[model samples]
Target: MRIGITLTDSRGPDALTRLRDELADAAANGMQSAWLSNIFGLDALTALAVAGSQVPGIEVGTAVVPTFPRHPVTLAQQALTTALAVSGRLTLGIGLSHRIVIEDMLGYSFDRPLRHLSDYLDALLPLLDGEPVDVRRETVRAVAGLTTPRVGRVPVLVAALGPKMLRLAGARVDGTVLWMTGVSTVRDHVMPTLQTAASEAGRPPARVVAMLPVAVTDDTEAARERAAREFEVYGTLPSYRAMLDREGVTGPADIALIGDEKSVRARIEEFGDAGVTDFVAAAFSGPDAARTRALLGELATAA
Candidate 1:
């Protein structure tokens, strides 16, 4: 399996520099990919452009950027620009963000999310595929000029969870990015649904990219505490809650891979056995930045 690291979207003064250094370190440590999560912070594509130039070898991807805030045409243009700047190393992961964030926070109606996503993909896919897109639907309508340069084969992944979203990912996207989902969930719930859909469509099996919090430490309690604190918000999110529950976890502490090297390695291999094509580790705890870097390096090599 391809292994990677995830940069947290923490909005602190040192976040950007830390992300850059992390990407450089990840590339140096032989990681195949480096992913950035877009929650409520800096633009992911812009960060990718910067990190891409600095780290020449590692693939740069967004675990996801929400589709509700921007039009599909605009996103396609932005993604293409980032892909060009990165020399075709960009993976554009887009999604319909949660209703609470879209409707409650952004004040946009969350009704008909699947339809909106379908319409958005219908227009966005062609634009990314180097075709002129003139699309009209109930939610999104766009007419694109044929003047823009095309970045060939910019892979688009989707943050799909439910049946409809998984079907859409199978039908239209290169892969699915999953968070907080355990190996069993992937084996029993996600993989079967998505793989069946892709098989039915006569397409290759969709890549299953699993993102999990990882901490390598003999100090299990401290590591779990750090993971719990960092991942607390996800536990409360309605979509994630059910997944967590099924894994017998109430919070991030319960789900995170926290233990000594042997235990962590075993946890990671479990995902591989569950048919995960890619593993993105979000390291959450250590003695310091140096220790965290060291652990990441070890995991990269071992992975």
Candidate 2:
């Protein structure tokens, strides 16, 4: 399985510089890819364009950019430009962000999200492939094509959790990128649902990129407590809550990979054995942060 690390910005004065340093460090440590989340902080695509230009040899991607905020045409344009800037190393991950963020925060209607994604991709995919887009669907409409110089088509991954989303992802996109999901869910529910949809669609086997908080430490209880506190909100989100339930786990803490190096390594191997295509580690070992990264780097090199 391909191994990578999720890199986040601190939102500090030198956030861009720090991001560049982090990318370089990840590459130097032999990581195959580095990913950033598109939250309320820095624009992930733009940050990667600037910082990733300075760092070579490691692939960079967005864990996800919410599809609600940007029109498909505009996103296609930006993603294409970013892909060029990053030397065709950009994997664009997108999703229909939760109702709370879409409706409550962004004041956009979150009804019929599945339809929105279907419509959004209808326009977005053609544009990314350097073709003219004239799609007009209920949730999205685009009539134009991009003028940006062609880089290779960007690989798109959807942050899909439920069966419907998984089917949509498998039928439409390259693969699915998962968070707050466990090995059991990946082995039984995710792999079956996603692969079956892809097979029915006559597509290649879908990639499963599993991401979770990881910690290599002796204080397992403390790590669990920290994970519970830091990632508590995910357990409350309905989508993530469903994944937790499907995994037969109570909360995010229960799904976290936390223990000494040996235990943590064993759990990660379980993900690979369960058919994960890529394993992205969100290291949160606090004082043992360096140690955790070292282990990830070692594993990545070995892979």
Off by over 4 Å in 2: none
Best of the candidates, lDDT = 2
RMSD of each: 1.9, 0.8
Q: Write model 2 residue lDDT over 160-237, tens digit each, in one string.
A: 999999999999999999999999999999999999999999999998899999999888898899999999999999
| Alpha carbon lDDT at 243, candidate 1 | 79
Task: Give the C-alpha lDDT of model 1.
Answer: 0.84
Local accuracy by lDDT, each model:
0.84, 0.92
Predicted model with the maximum TM-score: 2
Task: Return the TM-score for each candidate structure.
Answer: 0.94, 0.98
